[model samples]
Target: MIRFDTVSESTLMVHLADEIDVSMTPLIARLVGQIQADFPEQLIDLLPSYTSILIHFHPDKITERVLRERVQHCYQQWQNKPCSTQGKLIELPVFYHPDVGPDLTALAASQAMSVDEVIALHSGATYTVCAIGFAPGFAFLASVDEAIATPRHAEPRLRVAAGSVGIANQQTAVYPAQSPGGWQIIGNCPKPLFNPHQEPMTPFQVGDQVRFQPIDRQTFHSLGGEIWPHWK
Candidate 1:
């Protein structure tokens, strides 16, 4: 539980001091729904981190006293009530080939592991979609295997391919589209990570769990992989 206090008449923030796991996401979502329904004038801001939910609100919507009372009520409701939200589970297939994982060789050499070993370490682990930022459907992932926690590139790449799977710090994620990034690329997933044309656009939402299953280039092509042979 967070102890929230109004710092100013126009601003309110939540200090979430725990992992932003599935358990807390729906609770916060419910609270936000309640607030939006009750007070449409206020704006809610969420910061990305394992811990902390920050909220900013308008002074005219409600007074500090009223806001405090309301926040407490919402917080209590989250604590006592049971959550009834179910998020979608998605599986993306990756083809770990020389052409796909451009940095595979260098990454494997740095870690003193073979390219196959690196791929196995990455896809074998179940990763949490921490947040969708840095880019659209470009997930901020968590819970990467301890063995493959490689550092970001010293010099960021000018053009990282779309669908490239990469890692940084203790997290690993797939780059939704071709763009410059520093995360170490180890493989590529043919599926569109972020497709605005699709129903929800992004395959994984915040707090959704993502698991990767390995596939060969042929399988990836057969599974409806979209590869822009020439990136421009």
Candidate 2:
């Protein structure tokens, strides 16, 4: 719990009571907004480890002494309010075959598992998008099953085709574009995850639920569904 009190003309204090994760982010957002709305002059400094909140403000607008009083007011508001955690779920189809997952054998060997075992484990779980980074549509799906935990190739591939699904550090990610990466390749999804020409170029966002459905080679080529035929 964050406590509020008068301190100085340019500083306010915010505090936290627990670990910061995807679930608690909403609460933090609410707090951040509250401080910004009430004390527009203050800068919010959040410490996730100790769950401490510090408010640094301009001495000219609200004095350091009144800052404490303002913080107290905001803290009470936060306590009485609720944080939201609503999100959407998405399922993408992935094609995992020898051609696409050339390194599957290598990866399977590294983990001492058969190729089929690797695919089953990879596609069996509901993954949460921990974060969207490293590339335009690249997402860090939360930890994969412990059974298939493996490392990326020692030598990062020069160019990995777009839609390539790779695993690293217990998480699986789809390469939205043709980019060089070291994550162990296991599959590919034909769906266009990113298209700058279309509206909302990005498909997935942070915290979205994503599940990969596996398909074979023949289906992969057949389902390469034609892009909107503007001329034909």
Candidate 3:
């Protein structure tokens, strides 16, 4: 069931589901696309998250009631439309060594597993892009294997390096830029996930698929990946 609520005079939040998962993302994406296509003149922008789509509209262009009607119409149309499960599968190269991932050793110790076993579990599953938030290109990938599932750090680091991969509870993600975060650091991706000058800016979008591949230190450097010494 879809519920509509007003966030502000100019914003409407469309609640698509009560929980977050890969299955709900495609519907959210499609509904967003449909709304944008159908109401280009009235829509200011659309912000998508794990379970909801925040629709910002020009109140002067369209009244609140009219906007809701249009959104409801779009939702009805989406129900009859075929949704695509095929999203771009992005394979990211990650170096799980302690030198790059400071918390790798500690995480292994906490799980009662060796470093190699932890890395294998973390890289074994294919994750779906549930949302893109927390920062630019910072994708929330989900359903980390239970064997390696861990909690966030009690105290977040002041600056998590760009491309750092971390896991918190059932979710995992890469830090696309230097920022404060608490997720347990396990590895770092060599590729830049976000670029302001690029066309898409971020390589990922809602509903994309992601898989992490373990790599060596030499390969990490060869790929132009950098790790801040402060992180070690």
Candidate 4:
């Protein structure tokens, strides 16, 4: 069941489900595409999260009543059509070393697993991009293997470098820029995930598939990844 709530005069929140479900990704993508195609004039922005979508629109162009009606029509149309669960596959290379990932050794020790075992488990499975938040272009990927899953640090770090790969509970993500964070650092990716000058800005979308490729220190630096001062 879909529920709609008015956030403000020109904003609407569409509640798709009560809990986070990986299956909702493709459905959310389909619904967003449909709405964007149908309401090009009135929509200012649309933000999709784990279980809801927040829509901002032009009040002058369309009233709340009319907009809700139009959105409902689009939702119904999406429901009637077939939705694909697959999204674009993205393979990200990471240097999983103690020099870059400070928490890598500790996490492996806590789990009673060897460093190589932890790395294998993390890079073995393909994960789905469930949501993008915490920072621009930071994608929240879901379901790391249970054996290697770890909790976030009790206190967040003062600054985590750009391209830092981390895991918290069952979710994993990469820090697109240097910022304060609490996720357990396990690796660092070399790719630049966010570029302000780029058209898309982010390579990841909510439904995209992500696979982490483990690499050596040489490849990491060769790809423009810098080891921060503390890690060195």
Candidate 5:
């Protein structure tokens, strides 16, 4: 069932599901495309999360009541059409070590596993890009291996470097740019995730598949990765 809630005079949030499930990615992706195709003139923007989409529309172009009706119709048409989850698969090279990822040693200790074990567990699985928010190109990739899953820090760091890969509960993500954050840092990806001047802007999109490939320190530097200053 889909529920529509008023966010503002021009914004309506569409709740597709109550929980965050990876299966919902395809629905959310398709719905975004459908709404854009169906009402491009009236839509200002759309922000998708794990279970909902924040829709911004032009109030002058479409009334709240009518817009809701149109969106619901679009949802109904695409809801059961066998959408594919096989979006683009992007491989990210990560340097999993202590210098860039300050919490690596502590996180390993907490799980009673060696740092290499933690790294392997993290890099072994293919994850889905469920949502993108917090910053441009900051993608929320889902379901870190259960053995290596860890909680966010009780206190967020004042600044987390760009490309820092971290885990909070079942989700893992790379800090697309340097920003204050709290997710447990495990490694750093050398790829520059967001480039405003670039065509796609971000390498990640909702429903895309991501796999972290381990790399050594020298390779990390060669790829243009900066060493995050060690926390005092």
Candidate 6:
């Protein structure tokens, strides 16, 4: 079931589902596309999260009743259409070593698995880009392998470097910029996930697939990846 509420005079919140699943991402994306196509002049911006979409509209251009009706029509259209399996598969190069992954040793020990086993489980799974939040270009990828799923730190780091990959429960994500975070640090991805100057500021979008490719410290340095000195 879907629900709608007015977050503000210009913002409307559309709840498509109660849970966060990869299957639901495409539906949300399609709805966003429909809204953009149908009401180009009225839509100021649309923000899609794990289970809901927040739409910012020009109130002067669209009435509340019209907005609700249009959204409902789009939702119905999304439901009647077949799901599209096609999505971009992005491979991220990650360097997993004790020097960068502070929680690696402890997480492995807790799971009764070797560091290599942990890395294999994490890198092996193809995660879905469920939502982008917490920071700009911070793609929240879902369903990390159960065997390696770990909880976040009781105490978050004062500063987690950009491109640091971390796991908290069933989700995994990379820090787009230096910020305080609590997710268990597992590895570091050398590729910049976000750059304001770049054409596609974030490499990921809703419903995209992500795979982590492991590399060594030497390769990481060659790729211009640097570990924050504060971590050392």
Model 3 lDDT tens row, 1-232? 7899989999999887788766777877777777788789988988888889998999999888887787687778775677775569999999998777899999899889999999999898999888888898899998799888898988889888888999999999999988999999888998999999989999887778899999988999999987679872
Note the clash tally of each candidate.
Answer: 2, 11, 0, 0, 0, 0
Clashing residue pairs, backbone N/CA/C < 3 A, model 5? none
TM value for model 4: 0.93
**Candidate 2: C-alpha lDDT:** 0.68
Model 4 spans with C-alpha error above 4 angstroms: 74-82
Residue pairs with colliding backbones in model 3 are: none
Ranking of candidates on lDDT, top first: 5, 4, 6, 3, 1, 2
Please give the TM-score that candidate 5 achieves against the real structure: 0.93
Please give the range of 10 consecutive residues that has the lowest summed lDDT in model 2.
223-232
Candidate 3 lDDT trough over 10 residues, lowest sum: 78-87
User: How many pairs of residues collide in model 3?
Assistant: 0
Q: Which of the two, 1 or 4, has more TM-score?
A: 4
Per residue, candidate 5 scores C-alpha lDDT tens digits across 97-120 of 999999999999999999999998
Which candidate tops lDDT?
5
> Tens-digit lDDT track for model 1 on 111-180?
8999889888888887766556788788877767777788998899888888888888688899988899
User: What's model 1's lDDT at 161?
Assistant: 83
The whole-model lDDT of each prediction reads: 0.72, 0.68, 0.87, 0.88, 0.90, 0.88
RMSD of each: 4.2, 8.1, 2.1, 1.9, 1.6, 1.6
Q: Which candidate number has the best TM-score?
A: 6
Order of quality (TM-score): 6, 5, 4, 3, 1, 2
- The residue ranges of model 5 lying beyond 4 angstroms of the native Cα positions read 77-82, 230-232
Which whole-number lDDT from 0 to 100 does residue 36 have in model 2? 67
What TM-score does candidate 6 get on C-alpha atoms?
A: 0.94
- Write the residue-wise lDDT of candidate 4 on 29-129 in tens digits: 76777778877998999888888888899999878787678767767767657777657999999999988899999999999999999999999988988
